[model samples]
Target: MKKESKVFGIYPVIEALKANKTLDKLYVQKDIQNPKIQSIINDAETLSITINEVPIEKLNRLTKGNHQGIVAIISPISFPPFEDTVETILATKETPLFVVLDQISDVRNFGAILRTAECTGVDAVIIQKKGGAPVSGDTVKTSAGAIFNIPICKVDHIKDAIFYLQGSGITTVAATEKSGSYLYDLDLKKPLALIMGSEGRGISKSVLSIVDKSASIPLLGTINSLNVSVACGTFLYEVIRQRNH
Candidate 1:
């Protein structure tokens, strides 16, 4: 996927916002008291573009040209709202297979998981908006362009996603080492959303409480855990196997 475009300059940035550009984020000079800056801030607030105030040096570092204390980063891929993703998938009349990553901060792992998910025909991959990897150039390269092909939904909270999936009649299976149920034993031939947690902390306790089923991979060796991406792939393929059979 292409990198998000960065637009700088006060008038141009404001025009881009006025033209309804999908901005990834906006950066403004801190402590600017100009009326034009205040107008831009007001417009940004109305448009819901995330605004960050930083020093003039930071803006200078971003570009040597006249920035006029404003820069807007345009999103490359249009992120579909979570509700629209869910509704569209449900409208398809096919079994929905979603993968939700909880606090998975590693970019490579996130990309690898996306690659595997695309290969396995997953309907969508959901991630938290704040804690997860930002969909960037590295992620696109690592995902082998699967990031562009697959539908990725960003949510405010994984718990909210869990509840939404459950309400929509999709069974949520959390992949964790804490559970005794083997991946092989679970019934995976159903509309399901699989949750994969972080590498170090595992699934958050709050998320774990809401999952419909929790299963773990069997370890035959001394190592107690597998890499998050590897475990994600294993769990995904198991679902594929069950569904295919």
Candidate 2:
């Protein structure tokens, strides 16, 4: 019932954009004709923010006050500068590990993954600015405060982060059943990044294309897939196991 994470009205939304606020998404009134709305649309598109055009009723429900047909959801946590985070981790840690989340949208799964990453000694988490789960209060609760313990880097695209990691001599591996290899077969002791995709779609083809390797968790039962966060824990602990030996 808290609207603290939202900014309503045209002027406030516009100012939020201008201030470079960490925005998760934008909602505009459908078929509304206004020059300001068009300008906000253009700015949101340029920033790669997810935009939804909803009916006036939906906008009204989001806010009791006049919304002027716009509502912007503010992210709960600030994302660190991607390159600076990566560089600092590389400099400070020997055999640093990273978890690159490719659009993991479920808040519970995302929070659980953060907890696993922190427990498994992952140096940082990389996520896309638009497609991934919004860092909300539920995320904080589910993470059990681990969200504050780990550094998160948000990039424009998942593939770009993978490319940067590879350039920095970090091996990039993706978790997907489409791969022929198993997780146990990989040498994870080196500085590396593990990429996990969304719950329904798994990894996108474009992202999977650039990863240095791909591995799958063995499924012995009829179920072919594991929950994204559960799968992520399995993967991270494997890396920890390999490194410990």
The candidate that achieves the highest lDDT relative to the unseen native structure: 2
What residue pairs clash in candidate 2, if any at all? none
User: Model 1, 63-127: lDDT tens per residue?
Assistant: 77899888777766767899889999999957889999998888899889999999999999998
lDDT, candidate 2, equals 0.89
Q: What tens-digit string does per-residue lDDT give for candidate 2 at 1-245? A: 22228899989998899898878788899999999999999999887787888899999998898898899988767778899999998899889999999999999999999998999988999988776787777788888888888999888888888999999999999999989999999999999999999999999999888889999999999999999999999999999888888
Superposition error at 244 for model 1 (Å) = 1.4
Question: TM-score of every model?
Answer: 0.80, 0.89
CA lDDT of each prediction against the hidden true structure: 0.87, 0.89
How many Å off is the CA of 54 in candidate 1? 8.5
Worst 10 residues of 1 by lDDT: 129-138
